[model samples]
Target: MDPFEDTLRRLREAFGVGRTRPAEFRAAQLQGLGRFLRDNRQRLQDALAEDLGKSAIESDVSEIIMCQNEVDLALKNLHTWIKDEPTATNLFTKLGSAFIRKEPFGLVLIIAPWNYPLNLTLVPLVGAIAAGNCVVLKPSEISKGTEKVLAELLPQYLDQSCFAVVLGGPQETGRLLEHKFDYILFTGSPRVGKIVMAAAAKHLTPVTLELGGKNPCYVDDNCDPQTVANRVAWYRYFNAGQTCVAPDYVLCSREMQERLLPALQSAITRFYGDDPQNSPSLGRIINQKHFKRLQGLLGCGRVAIGGQSDESARYIAPTVLVDVQETEPVMQEEIFGPILPLLTVSSLDEAIAFINRREKPLALYAFSNNNQVVNQLLDRTSSGSFGGNEGFIYLTLPTLPLGGVGNSGMGRYHGKFSFDTFSHHRACLLSPAGMERLNEIRYPPYSDWSQQLIRWAMSSQSCTLL
Candidate 1:
């Protein structure tokens, strides 16, 4: 039997019914999820450590706390999100009152990636439930330990009929997609995202794809070298540079590169100590496959600061490579690891040109104190999202619509955006009994006089009808 089918069966049996539209039941489920996280916080942290080698602090802050916050935000705003929103009617339809009703898209499928596995899965699930939809969450099998824990724990807290966690690899995922779903949400690499999208197209089901790309960072001469270095080091090395929004490469003037390299070295050492391989703060690559990919990129550029690796433990130190050409493999692909490549250009215009020559990046960062330089970069570059004078902090904001465009991917979800994503905005018109007489002129059989009267009626701004 298909694993998703079996899992869906279990969920249906647990909920004691196949489906339900009770808002009160959804509220209770959200409240239960909040209580589950609060009570089992340590377990979640331990699972993250076993699965991805994330430090206790990183797991607590990024995974557990963020997931809990999403649940809390949804619970607080559910009443408003569920309410009907009245809309203004056009003059032609003035006799009827129009409103948009937010309705759930039946069963939802969420395919989450390995990096930040819990957060990516649970955050979207919060929106799915808040919008009153059933969800079948497929946590990444790459993070087996975390996936096992989720499969065990989620059912304990949520309404099993409404929410379920399915376990398996790609084959299982393919089987799950074979069945129709009301909506699907996927997060991972662009290559795999295409497969998900293709499958979703079969059902004509709407989807939200959050995929990664070669995100770029530009450091201008006017910026403070030390401050820029510190910020870049923090973001690049955070989660071992596995973050999708992490700066993939640096573009700057040759003179600025000379001033920035030493400061970057200082920041890396400060954060991870002399030997990052032994540092407790730095995380290891999730698996050997990723570790080998980073090792291959090191051959493409000269090591500016650190280039150390341990294949056995899946460890790669905070590495910085300089003098990397655009054709180099490191510059070509999305470096989803702790290896930062630096490409020096003579002018800011050259830097912008270099960025424009490639596919649109998921995120862009420009470090400059000059307002003109910042404004120019923002106006010219095409990216899914960007930050000026900062690094990867935009991903932390709950209000922003977080997703990609073009090759990076499509669709966005966060805060109220998620509610809108999982819902179908159905327009409704309410007309009173007496309003039928006014709409008679819009009815079928037409004479020349009636046509003139119809045109006059539409053209007139006054409420009076002819």
Candidate 2:
């Protein structure tokens, strides 16, 4: 007997009965989710801290607040989003009305990552529910604390008849993937993204993959070194640099690199203090495996600042590396740790060329006092998101979509896009059943004169009015 069969069947039945199609039901679920975030704010923060060594402020701002905004946005716009969108009718179809109905995709599966477990799990859930789809959320087991809370408390907030929280690592996920789902939204790495896509392909299931890439940050010679250092350091080190959109490496000139090193060193010290391992603001690695991987990376690039690591605590200081080779292990992979590597480029054109050579990044950052330099980078490259003089702060806005392209990943979601992602836009036409005269041209069989008259009426621009 399949363990998830009963749960999947129950949800599919609920969806079949049209229990989730109404705007009121969607808004209710959104409000329930909003209350869940607000009521359990502290608990969620503690769970995030326990699971990933995230600071309370970091958890609140990035995870809790972002999820809350998604909930709020969905609740506020559900009615507007659910309405049928009227479309222009062709002359032949002028007697009928054409419109698009945003309908649910039935049962949806959401596989969230461990880095920002709650936010990733619930944010997509908010969208799936708002689009009138029942969802099964599988929170990352690596984030045990947050996963526990979601498995237990989250079901109580949302309607259990339609929503479920499944738990497990790879084996269980594999088993779950065997079952057909109407849609799947997965937030993880590209390696696993292939697995999810392959699973979805068996049933021709639609999928949205939010995967990561080595996001590049191009620091130009024109900017204040300290400002660029601070912004880059904060986002890179935020959530211990596990963020998918974090700037993975710095591309700047040798002169700018020299200036950036000192500024970055000062900024790291100011933010995390002399002993970052003991600092409350700093975070630890999620597990020992990741800690060992990060430790191995420390040996590649020459350490420029704060290369310290403690295996027992799974802690790596806000570190920097210089003289990093393009082919070195540190330069080759997405460093999902607090270590920042600076590779010198000869000029702005050279930096752009280097970025163009690699796979299109998930996010790109260009920092400069000159707007043209930033614009040039923006125009020259393709990335999921481009940050000019900023970091991943764009996530705060529900209007903008977050996603990736090419090697990074595909599909986008956030606020309304999330709802639209989980929904199917169905084309609908309505007309009186007995409009025999109006539909005569659409029917077969006619004399030459009748056919000519009908064709003219159908093709004439003046025939727009019925």
Candidate 3:
């Protein structure tokens, strides 16, 4: 017997019966989600610590608080979001009601990654529930502690008929993908994103892929090295540099690089302390696999500061590498760890050209006192998100969207964008039964006068004053 078969069927059956369609039910679910975070704050923090060595503050700020905020936002605006969006109609349809109905896309599958397990999982789950879809959440198996907590405890807070948590790694995920879902939302690497896309294609299901890439951060000579270093180092090594949107590499002139090196080193020491491995704020790598991978990257460039690794603890000290070539292994892939590489580019145009030559990143950063440089980077380049003299603090704002372009991924989610992604905007129009007279012109009337009238009614000119 297939393990997921019964659960998927049950959720689909529940969705078909409209158990989650009511605004009250959605609000209840959102409230329940809120309670789960509030009630299990410590439990979740412990789980995150065990899995990723996340500090309690880091877990709350990045994962728990964000999820809570999303749930609150969705609950507060559930009625407004679900209300029929009224649209303008042409002259011929002026007497009819035309609007878009935000209907749920039945069964949804949310595949989350391990880096920030709770945030990625529950954030999208909040959207799915708000949009009134039955959801099956597959939290990352790699984050076993969080996974266990989610599987064992999260279901207690949600309606089992409408929501479920599944357990598995790649094989089970592959099997799960074989089944059909109305929509799929995946957050992971571009490599796995392609697999998810391909699986979603088999059933002709729409998907929102939140994948990561080599997000670049460019520093200009006009900026203060210490300030820039403080901002970059904090975000780059926040989750032990396991952030998808973290500045993967740095691009600046050799002169600026020289200034940045010591500043970055000082910032790291300040943030993680001289003995970072002993700091409570610092996190360890997820597992041996990732630890080994990150440890190998240390050989790419000369370690300017802090290139220490402990296999037993899965700890990699907050490290910065200099003189890294563009073709180096550290630069070739998304360095999703506590390692930052610096590469020299002589001019702003060269830096722009260098970034343009690569796959569009999930997020891009530029540090400069000159607003024109920031604007130029913004206007000339394409990325999912851009940070000017900042890091990914924009994520905390629900008004802004988080997504990717090109090889990074597809689709945006955060706040209302999340609600929209899980919904299908069904176009609906209701005409009065008594409006038979207006219908004749739109029907099989071949007369010239009727044709002319129909054409005029269909055009924008007849709708209102120009």
Candidate 4:
């Protein structure tokens, strides 16, 4: 027996009755979402703190504010986003009105990951609502505190007939995927990404996967070491370095690595303090299983700085590894923790070649005092997002999108792009039904003159119907 069939059917029924299609309805849903964020700010922050040791400020900036912005943008532009767009006409259809209609895909399923649970779930929910589609949100079960709040509270704010929050782990998700959905958006690892894609393929469902990868940062010999160190350390260790877009590893020469070591040490101390485990800015691993996995990774290379681990607290200090081999475990996988490995490459060409050889990352960074070096790295490499002499600060811009290419992930969403992703642009034309004389001339009776006249009328810009 299918447990979700009834719920799915109800949402489908609501969508079929045009419950989500109106501009006012979409605006109201978005406004309600914004209010939810506004009214429950501290509760959300506390949930994040419980799950990942995330500070209230980090929770606000990275997750809460970003989601709120998407809601605001969608509500402000709902009517404009829903309007039919006019298209150029052919000569044969001079009197006809041709336009593209942006219509909803009925019901959509969004499966969010644990790293940024609230932001990932709500951002895509914002798009599905704005595009006039009923949504089924599956929050990560691993982030139990956040998941409980969303499952209980978010539904109260949203129209329950069109919105539902289902809770589950891998087993329940597998069952959920067995049902047919108009669209599916997943955020997680590539291994799970393949499973989601495979499941989506069975139903011929369209999916937007936001998966993780080993995001690379290339440091040039011409750059300032302390500047590079601070940027890399903060981004790498932010949210205990669980961010999908954070710089995962460093590629520089042995000389630059030497300069970066103490600079990184200085930065880590400045940000998290001498005892990083007690530092409120630092976060612990998500769970004991993940802590064990990260603990095993510490033996990969010579630990340059901060290699302390406390299994009881799930704490692994902000660490930097040096003289690391590409074939080591730390280098083999996307390190989703507060560990940054510095691997030495001979030159910029070598660094670029290194990045190209692997799967394209979700985000890539290159730090240099010279513009030519930055350009060369940018020109040679491909990633979902790029940062020059900075970190993932570009995520602040709603105009820019966030996604991955190749093995990293697929599809994009943020601001207007989110609205467009959930909508289907359908080509339509309205032509006259009463022009019998004009219609009859082009039908049945074929002659040399008729053929020439019809061809000219259809193809020529200078000619039209009588």
Candidate 5:
């Protein structure tokens, strides 16, 4: 028996009946989502703390606020986004009105990751709802607290007919993937992404895979070591360094590496204090599996700072590793924990070569006072997104898109891009029934005079209708 069959059928019926098609219905759904976040803010924060040891501030800033902003953006632009977009016509269709009508894909599946669970789940939900689709949200089972909150509390705020929160692990997810969906947006590793892609292929369903890669951070000698360290440290260790876009490794000259070491130590100490484990600000690894995995990675390179770990607490310190080789395990995989590796490069060209050699990362960072050096790195290498003299601050803006290029993943989403991704842009043309005279030129009676007239009428220069 298919466990998800009944639920999927009910949602499909709801969507087919146009319960989610109206602009008012979409807006109301978005507003309800906003209320869910606002009404249950504390509960959500507490869940995050329980699951990942995130402080209230980190939970609010990284998850709640980001989700709220997306909801607000969708509401502010919902009417504009739903209206038919007028498109320029060629001479071939001068008398007809053509435009793009954005319609929902009927049903959407959003499979979120454990890291920033609320943000990843709800942000995409905001888009799917605003685009007028019945949605199935599969929150990460690893983050049990957040998953419980979503399963128990979230459905109360949404129309149960159209929105659902299904809970399960890998086997259940595999079973769920067997069902067909109009669209699927998954956030996780590339290996799982491939699995999702393959499952989606069975039904010919389109997907948006937000996968991770070894995001490289390049620090040039021209910059302030303290500034780079602060930015890198804050982002790298944020959410216990589980961010997909966080800088996985740093490439810089030996001199800069020397200068950066102390600055990084200062930042770590200042942020988390002399004893980081005791600090309330620092979070822990998600679970024992991840903790053991991160502990194993700690042996990859010579530790320059913070190599401490507590298995019982699932805690790994804000660690920095130096004298690491490209062939080392730390450099080979996406370091999704609080471990940052520093590998020295003699010049800018070497850094670019090193970055280009690897799979294009989801995010790349280049810190330099000189604009040209940053620009050179930007022009030379390719990544999903580039951060210049900063970290992943670009995610805050709705104007920019968040996605990957090659191995990192495919497809873009966030704000308007999110709505577009969930909605299908259907090309439409409306022609007047009385314009049979204008259609006469397209009829098939062979004649030299008519041929020249038709040719001229269909030409680019003949766009003006007579």
Candidate 6:
């Protein structure tokens, strides 16, 4: 059989005619997932370490435990999330009951990235399962150990017919995409995201693209330098700066830079110690290619603090660069490694303009104690989401909808948003028997009197009945 056909057949068999009552079974499945994660925490962490060389704590926080949290949250809130939402009806429809029914998209394909493989895959998986859809998960092959573990454990713990992991590379992904699905959720680089969207377009399937960008963090002069520096340093180097929402670069006034960079340097030293290479908290680049890419960016910008690497280990120290121009490669793209570029701006307007000049980022951050400055920045700039005086914390909150706009990405999914993402808001209008007279005005008729009456009745200012 063809690969596409094989995948489709497997999914169909798993979903049992693609009609499982998601509302009835999602809570139990989520509970099972939570238990599965708790029962096999050590094994999952070990697998992540083997696959990506992630430290135990990083693996736990970024992957396994995160998935466990999502499962627990889904289980706790499934009932409220799954209920049909009642909507306000207009006067014309007052005799009719109007409500929105959240119905599942039949089959969904989730293509997750290598960085935070488990969290990215399972978080969306929770939503798909919660919304009562069959899922075909394609975990990143680069993290083969984690991929293998998930493929093995998922079938055992969950409904095998409703959820299955397909393990392979680009070829496998290509085959999987050949068969049309009701929805596709992909989290990856912008270039790859575009390809996924284009392929999805052929089938007219809806998609949620969580693409990356050069997310910027603005540190205004009025803010406390030490506090901003500490937060910035921690977020910039978190997960070795591999996060899609990690502060890609910083924009601060030249005077603030003098104060901020030194504090940032101190924070980095404090967090990773004098030698970050041996620091347990510091992580390595996922592969040699990424290491080389980050190493190459160091040349484009002047080094402000620690610019070093170990290619064999795929290690790059928490490096900082100053006086970075827009022409620099680091400034040009998403610096998805342990590198932070600091650019000086003369005014907040200049900072806002710089951010506006680029594609809308997935997350935009501003650090200011002044409410007016915060309001101005929020009003002037547009992003997928904004965080005030915080970095990357927006993603930690399960309540907010996380996504991108413009080139950064399209569509969003998190908590209830995820359920909404996989669900089609089907509209139902039930008209009362007495409202049958109202329908006469909408029926086909060519009389001038009928046309005039119809126009008058449909006008916003008029309240005439048919």
TM agreement with the true structure for every prediction: 0.95, 0.96, 0.99, 0.96, 0.98, 0.93
Q: Model 6 over residues 128-213: C-alpha lDDT tens digits?
A: 98898888889998877778888888778877667777888888788778788889999999999988988999999999999999
The lDDT for every candidate, in the order shown, is 0.85, 0.91, 0.94, 0.92, 0.94, 0.84
Question: Which candidate, 3 or 4, would have the higher TM-score against the true structure?
Answer: 3
Which is the better candidate, 3 or 6, if ranked by lDDT?
Answer: 3
Q: Give the per-residue lDDT of model 5 (tens digit) for 131-154.
A: 999999999999999999999999
Candidate 4 Cα outliers beyond 4 Å, as residue runs: 439-466
Model 2 Cα lDDT, one tens digit per residue, 146-212: 9998898888888888999998899999999999999999999889999999999999999999998
Better of 1 and 3 by TM-score: 3
User: Residue 118 in candidate 5 has what lDDT?
Assistant: 98
Prediction RMSDs, each to the true structure: 2.3, 1.9, 1.0, 2.1, 1.2, 2.5
User: Would you list the clashing residue pairs of candidate 2?
Assistant: none
- Residue-wise lDDT of candidate 4 within 185-214, one digit each (tens)? 999999999999999999999999999999
lDDT of 3 at 344: 92
> Candidate 3, which segments miss by more than 4 Å at Cα?
none
Point out where model 1 deviates above 4 Å. 9-20, 447-453, 456-466
Span of ten consecutive residues with least summed lDDT in model 4: 457-466
Task: Give the poorly placed runs of model 2, Cα more than 4 Å off.
Answer: 443-466
